[model samples]
Target chain A: MPNRNRLHGEEGRAYWSMVLPAFSIYLLVMAFPIVLSIVLSVSNYSGGKMFGGEPWGFAGLKSYARVFSDPLFWNALKNNFYIVLLSVFGQLPLGFIFAYIIYRRLVKWPGFWQGVLYVPNIISVIVVGLLWQTIFSPNGPIAEVMNDLARAGFQSRLEALFASVGGFNVDDGLVSKILDMAGPAALDWFSDPVPELKELILSYEGAPLSELIGDLCNLFVPRWSPEFLSKPNIAMLPVLFVILWMYTGMYLILFLANMQKIDSQVIEAARIDGASEGQVMRYVILPALSGTIVNSAILAISGSLSSFSLIFAMTGGGPSRVTEILSIYMYNNAFLGRPNLPLANAISLVMVVISFILIGLTKMAEKRYGGKEE
Target chain B: MSDEIKTTALGRIGGAAAKAAAYAMMLLFTAMTLYPIFWLIMNSFKSTREFQVSQLAFPKEPTLSNYVEAWKMGDFGLLFPNSLIYTIGATVGIVFVSLLAGFAFAKIASRATKPIYNGFVIGILITAQSLMIPLFLEVNLLGIYNTRFAVLLVYIGTGLPIGVYLATEYIKAIPSALIESARIDGASFWRIFAKIIVPMSMPVAVTLSILNISNIWNEFALINILVSRTELKSLPLGIYKFSGSLSTDYGKQFAALTIGMVPMLLFYIVFRKQITRGVAAGAVKG
Candidate 1:
C-alpha cells in the first residue's frame, strides 16, 4: 500500500507537469481576455486617449445603457433574434429532414449525399455571400423569374386580375417602373450612397403589399444593389441565407449521426405496433432526438449570437448600422468605433456576459436532459 | 390465398411509394447542395458577360480567363504557401501537445490532477470569440502580432482543450496493464509514451490531425487579425481580398472560391469516413 501511494504521488507529479504548460497558455490567452474585458467595460477611454496618458475612470453601466438605448442596437438585436429563429426552426429542421432522408430512407450512395450537403459548409462565408448576392441580384436569375412573372403576357388572367387589384399594373405600377429602371440600368439595392432606396422604403410606411413592391422595384432596378458590404438590410438577407445554407449541412450531419444510434429494434417495434409514419416520427424519432434537438438549438442560438467573421466580411455593419450583431458590434467598437478603446472593451464585456448567459442556460438544459442518460 | 396475396401486393406498393418519395427528397436536397458548387465551377470558366447573362445555365463558350485573372488578382500562389505553413505547423504542434496532455490525464494515476484535467473541459466551453480582444492584446504585447508564429501559437492554444479531451477519451480505453508492463521492464515515462501510447493511439491521432489541418487551413478570423501583411494571409483571407479587390467581378470571385476550396474538398473526398467520424465524435463529446 505504501509503495502504491508513492507510485501514485510520482504519477501525480508527472501528470501535473505535463498539463501545466498547456493550461498556463490557455489561462493567459483565454482567461486574460475575459478578465480584461470586464475591467474595460466600466472604464472611460477613447482611441488617442487609450494610447495616451488618459487614466481609466469608472463609468458604471453607461456603455451597456448606451447599447441598450440605441435604436440601432435594438434593430440589430431584433435582427439577431430573427436570424437565430430562422436558423433553429427553419434551418435545423430542414437539415435534419435532409439528413434523415439521406441516411436512413434513401437507398443510394450516402457519401454522395453527404458531400453534396456539405459543399456550402466548406465554402467561405464571403464566397457564399457573393454567390447568393449574384443569384438574388436584379439581373440575376431569381429576379429574371420575378420579372417574367410580372410581365402581363406571362401572367395567367386570374393572376393579372389579382395583380391589377393589388395595384401592380405592368404598364404603370411601381413594379413595372422598377423592372424598367433596374432591369436595364442595374439599381444598387442596399447602398446607393445617395440613400434613394432607404428613402423610398422609409417613405412608404402605411401602404401594404403595393408599397413594399414599389420599394423593392425601385431598390432593385437602375442600380446594382449597393455593394453587399455597404448595404446592411439587403446585405443581411444574403448573409443570413448563406449562413442558413452552410450550417444546415453541419446540423444535418449531427442529427443524422444521432439518428443512426437510435436502436433499429425500437423503430421496428414502432412500425410493428401499427404506428403511421407521421406518428412514428412525431413520437419516437423526435423524442429520441430530444437531446440533439436541444443541443443543436442552443448551439444555433449561441452561434448566431457570437457570429462575426461572416457579417464582417459580408456587410461590416454598414448602410447606417442595419446588420450589426453583438459580436460585430463589439469588434467594430474595439477596432474601428472611433478608436474608443474603453467603449470597445465595454462592448466586449457585455458580449462575454451575453455569451456566458446563453451558454450557461444551455448547460442547464443539457444537464436536465443528459443527466438521465448518464 | 388470394387475400394474403392481395395484402402482400399492397405492402409492396406502399414500400415502393415510400422509396420513391425518399429518393425524390434526397435528389432535391442533393441538387440544392451541389448546384451552387457546380455553378461556381462553371462560372470560373466563363467571361464576365456570360456569367451576367446566365447565372444558372452553362457558359456559351468556356474560357480560362477567369481562372487566370483570379489567380493573378488573388495572388493565390503566395497565399497558398503561407496557409500551408501555418496550417501544417499549427496542426503538428496541436497534435503533439494534445497527445502528451491527453496521455497524462488518461493514464497517469493521480487523484490530485483530476481537477486540473476537468479544468481543460471548461476551456471547451470558452470559445475563441470570448477571448478575441485579450488574445489580440496579448499577441501584440508579445510582439508577434503579425508574424506566422502568433497565428500558430493561437491555434495551438485554442485547439488544446478539444485535442486533450479527444485524446484522453481515446487513451482511457487502453488498459493500464500495458503501460505497467512496460514500466516494470524499466522503461522511462518518455519511452512508454513514445513506443506504446503513440503507436496504440495512431488512429485517433490521424483523425485528430485531419480535423485540425482542415480547421487551421480554413481559419480566417484569427489569421485575419494577427497577420497584417497581405502576402502572409491564409486561403480564406486571400479569398476575402479577392472579393474586396474584384467586388463587381463575380466570375473571378467564384473562380477564386472554387480554386481555394479544392484542397479541402479533395481531402474530404479522400477521407470521408474518417473525417465525418471525427467530426461526429467531437460534436457529441463537446
Candidate 2:
C-alpha cells in the first residue's frame, strides 16, 4: 500500500511540474497586474507617494465623473476617431494596392521592394516622428517645393490671362502692380505667403486657383483673413496629416499581407467568366480577405485610440489641444496635470473599455463573415 | 487574318498596360518607404547647423566623425557587451524553461491539470503595457531592481507565453511513437528528451532564439523602468539618453539609431527565411 501510494504521488508530481512554470509566469505578469490596475483605479495611488505613505482610501465613482467632465478628454476622444478613420479608410486600401502590386510579380525585384516598404516598420517611432516633423516644418524641403510650385502656377496663370487679352508682356510692371495689390504682403512667390498657401492647399478642399486667390485676397483685403491654425473648422487638418503619415505604412503592410493570401485561382476564375478586375476584386478577393481587413481595421482603431508616442513626439498634442488623443491626455493627467492619479486611472480604464468594445465588434463582424482560416 | 491579329495585339497591349500600372504603383510606394531611412542616413553625415539649414541636401563633405563621437560618448563598447549578456542570459533561461513546460503540456495527460494549462493560455490576452507599472513595483520588492538580473527576469517572464505556445505546437507535431520506442529500449525520460526530443526540435529552437533576440534588442520600456543605473542600461535606453544629451547633434542621434538597429538588421538578413517562417507559424499557433 505504501509503494502504490508513493507511485501515485510521483505521477501527480510529474503532472504539476509541467504546469508550474507556465503558472508562475501568468501569475507574475498577467494576473497580478490586472488585479492591481483595478485596485489602483478605485483607490488613490500616485507615483510620487510610496505604497504606505498615502492615505490608502477608496474614492468611488468620482474619478470616472472627473474624466467625463474634462474638455481635454473629449478632444482626445475626437482625435482618436480621426486617427481611426484615416488609418482604416486611407492606409488600409493603399497598403493593399502596394502588396497586390508586389505579390503578383508585377514589380521586378520584389524582395528589394519589400525591404524598402518594411523599413519604416522597423525604425523606432521616435525617428519616424522626427523625420516627419522636419519634412512638414515651415522651412523644410516639402514646404520649399510647395512654395516654388505656387509661384510657378501664379506666374503661368497670370501670363496666360494677360496674353489672352492681347499682346501683354509679363516682364512689364502691370502684372506686378496687380499682384502687389492682390497678393499677400505684396510678397514674391518665394516668400512665406506662398508656403502657407501651399500648406493650405495641401490640407483644405476648395477650388484650387480660386482658393489661392481667395486666401490671398483675404490676407491682403482684411475681411477674408482667418487664423490658419485657429480657423475653428480647419485646425484639425495639420494633426490629421501628421497622424496619417506615421501610421499609414504600418496598416498598409498588414492589409497587404492579408490581400496576398487570397488564392489567385478564385480571381482567375472570376476573370475568365468575363468579369472585370473591379468585379473580381469586389466579389472574390474582397470576400476572401474580409476577415483580414476587419482584423486590421480593428487593430488600426485600437492603435489609433492608444496612439501616444508619435503624437507626443511630434505635436505634443499641441495647437490648442487639437491633436490630443486619450493616451496623451492620460499621460498629462498622471504626470503633468494635477497628478490626479484617480482621474488618470479612470480615463485609462475608460480607454481600455473602449478598445475592448471596438475589438469585440470586429470579432462579431469577423464571425459573421466567417472566421479567418489559419 | 489581319483583324484576328489586330485583336490579339490589342489584348497584349491591354495586359502590358495593366502590368506597367502595377509597376508604377510599386515604384511609388518603394520610394516613399525608402525616403525616411535615406533621409536619416544622409542627415547623419551632416553637422547640426547644416541639417537645420538644409534638411534634404547632401552634406558638402560627408564625415565619419559623428559615428566616432557616438561610439565613445555613448560608451557603446561597454554597453554592447552588457546588452549581449542580458539578452543571451534571458533568452537561454526563457527557452529552457518554456521548452520543459511546453513538452510536458504536449506529452503529458493529467485531467486535474487542464485548468492550470488553461490559465497559462489566459496570459496571452493581457497586454504587456497594462502590467508594466505593477511589474516594476514587484521587481523593486524582489530587491533585484536596477540590476541586470531584474531586467533578465522581466524579459524571461514577458517572453514566456509566446515561447511556450510555440514550443508546445512544435512538440505536438513530433510523433509519440519515437518517445515510446525510446522508452521501450529502457531509456530514461531525461535521456529521451535530451537525445530524441531536443534534436528534432532544433528548428523551432533556432526560430524562437531569433524572435527573442529581435524582441529583447528592441525592447525599451522594460529596460527604462527596471534599470535606473546608467551603467546597466541596454542599447535602446542608452541610445535614447545619448539622443537627449546631444540634442542638437542629429548626426550622432542617427548614428546611434543606426547602430542600435544593426544587430537585428543583420540577424534578419542572415536568417530571413527562418524568421519569416517562424512568424507565420507562430502567428497561426498563437
Candidate 3:
C-alpha cells in the first residue's frame, strides 16, 4: 500500500524545499569555510581585504614556508604533541583505572564519585582556567609548597638552566666535529664535571654550549623563586593537571558505560575459576574494553590537536610562549596581532591537515584494536 | 584447627584494610574534583581583605556586595537578555530546520537525498579551526559580521548537520505504514509530517534540543570571532573579558565568574539527567 512510485512531480518539489534550507546552510557554513581557508592560505588576505577594501591576490607558498621556518611555529607544533601525549598517555589509563574501580565496586559510592568528577567538564573553560590560576599563582598553593620545600633545604625541585633542557647528541652535530678540531677545550662536554655542558647540543636551546648564564652572584635571583608558575620549563604542569581533571571524568563515564555492556557470565566464569581480581582485570576485563579504549583514544587525539579556549584563557600563550599550541598561535596571528589573515589561514589549514593525519593514524590503530568507527 | 583459625583472622584484617583504602580513595578523588569550584564559590562571597589574607579559609564575613559590584561591572543586565535571545532563537531555528529536512530524508525517497545526507554527515568531522577563517570572510561577504544575527546564523548553520543526522537516523526507525496511510487519505506531505511524524519523533526532538542548546550555549570560538560588538557578545564571550577586567580584585573577578557560572550550573542541575543522557549518546555516536 506504500506509494513506491519513482516519478518526479509535486512530491519532488516539496521534498527539495524541505531539505535544501538545512543542506545549503551546511554547505555555506562548513564546506565553504574549508575551501575558503585553503584559497585564502594560498592568497594574500589581510587588514580587512574583503569588507570594501583592497582586492585579494595570490601569495603562493610564501606563508607556508614562513610557518614552517619560525622557531615559534616549531614550538607550537611540539607543544601540540605534548597535549596529545597527555591525553593518550595521561588521561586514558587513569580514566580506565577509575572506571574499573567504580565498575568493579572496588571503591565506595561509584555513582557519587562519577558525578563529582564530571562536574568540571560542564563548567566554563574560563572558570577552570582562572581556578587553576589561583592554585598556580606565585603566592598560591603549589608555589607556596615549593617555597616551603626550598626553605627546608629541599633544592631538588629547582631546575638548573643550562643542564635542564634536551640532552646533547655528540654523535650527530657539527658541534661534535668542531669539538674535535678545537681540542680538549671543546670536549669539556664529555668531561665529568661539566654535565651541564653535555646537555646543550640536544636542541636549539643554548645549542652553542657557551650560553650558560647562571645566577652566579645570586643578587637579583632567589635560590628558589616562589613564582614557579612563570617558569617556562614547568608552566604546562598546571594546564596538564586541569586538562586531566576536566576530561578524565567524561572518559570514565564512557569506559564505565562500555564496561556495563560486557557480558557478566564471562566475568563469573573467571571468578569461579578462582582467578584473583587482578588476573580477571589483566586477562579478561582489559581485552574486552580495548575497542572503547581505541575509540576514546581517537577522540582524545583529535581533541588535543585542536584545543584552544582553555589554554588561551589560562596562558594566552604567554610567559614567553611556553604553552603555545598551534591553534593559539593561529589565533594570535588572525585576531591578536596585525591581523595577518594569510598566515592565519595557512596555520588553520595546517592544523586541519594535522588533525586529519592524527585521526587517520588513530583510525588505523582502532582497526587493529577491532573497533569499527561508530 | 589453630592454622585455620589464624588464616580466618588474617582475612578479616585484610578485608578491613581494603575497605578503608577504598573509602580513602573515593574521598580523596572527591576532594580533588570539587575543591577548585568550592574555592571559587567561597572566594566569590569573601571581601577583598579576606581574599588577600587567606585564599583557602572560610569567609569571616560573607557579603553580597561583590556580586552587586560585579553585576554592574559586567553589565549582565544587558548580556543576560542577549545570551537568552541567542540561545533560544538559534535552538528554535535549528530544531525547525532539522525536523523538516529529517522528515524529507526519512519518508520522501529521492535519488539526490542519499548524497545530500552523506554531505551533512561529513560536517561532523570538520573542526572549528578549519572553519574559522572562511566563516569570518563569509560573514563579511554577507555583511553580517558583527551583528548578533550573524552569530545566530552560524550557530544554526553548524548545528544543522548533527541535528539533521540524528533526526534522520531516529525517524528511519519509524514504520513507513504511518506515512503511507496518511498519503492514502490524500493528506499533503507537511500535513502528514506535522500530524504523524512530528508526534512520533518527539523523543529524538527532545534529545536534539538538549544537545543543540548545550553546545550552542557553551560555544566560544565561533561567536568570539564573529561578534566583535561588545554589547552583542554572548555569555561565554562576555565572561572571557573578565580575565582582563578585574585582574586586580580577585574577589570581584571571582564574583563576576560566579554570576557567569550560576545560570549554566542551574541548568545542568535541573536537566542533569537530560545532559548525561545527551553526553552519553553523543559519545556513542562519535
TM-score of chain A of each: 0.72, 0.72, 0.74
Best DockQ among the predictions, by candidate number: 1
Q: Write the per-residue lDDT of candidate 2 for residues A120-146, one digit (tens) a residue.
A: 544445455555554555545566565
When sorted by lDDT, best at the front, the candidate numbers are 3, 1, 2
TM-score of predicted model 3? 0.82
Query: TM-scores of all models?
Result: 0.82, 0.78, 0.82
lDDT of 2 by residue, B173-272 (tens): 9998887787679876567667987898888888788777766766675676688776898776667654334645677876776777667667767766
Question: Please, what are the lDDT tens digits per residue for candidate 3 over residues A1-374?
Answer: 23454636768877988898898877888778878889888888775656458887888999999899989889888887877788888888877877887887766677777777777878777777766766677646565455445433312211232245333334334334333333454433355423433344344454443332222112112334455457898888778888988888888878888888888788777766656557878998888877787778767766776478788888878779878888888888887747888888888889778656755665477568754323
- CA lDDT scores, all candidates in order: 0.70, 0.64, 0.74
Which is the winner by TM-score between candidate 1 and candidate 2?
1
Steric clash pairs (candidate 3) = none
Candidate 3 docks with a DockQ of 0.33
Candidate 1 residue runs with Cα over 4 Å from true position: A1-13, A47-59, A144-235, A371-374, B1-14
Q: Which regions in candidate 3 have their CA more than 4 angstroms from the true location?
A: A1-7, A143-225, A358-374, B1-21
lDDT, model 1, position A198: 36
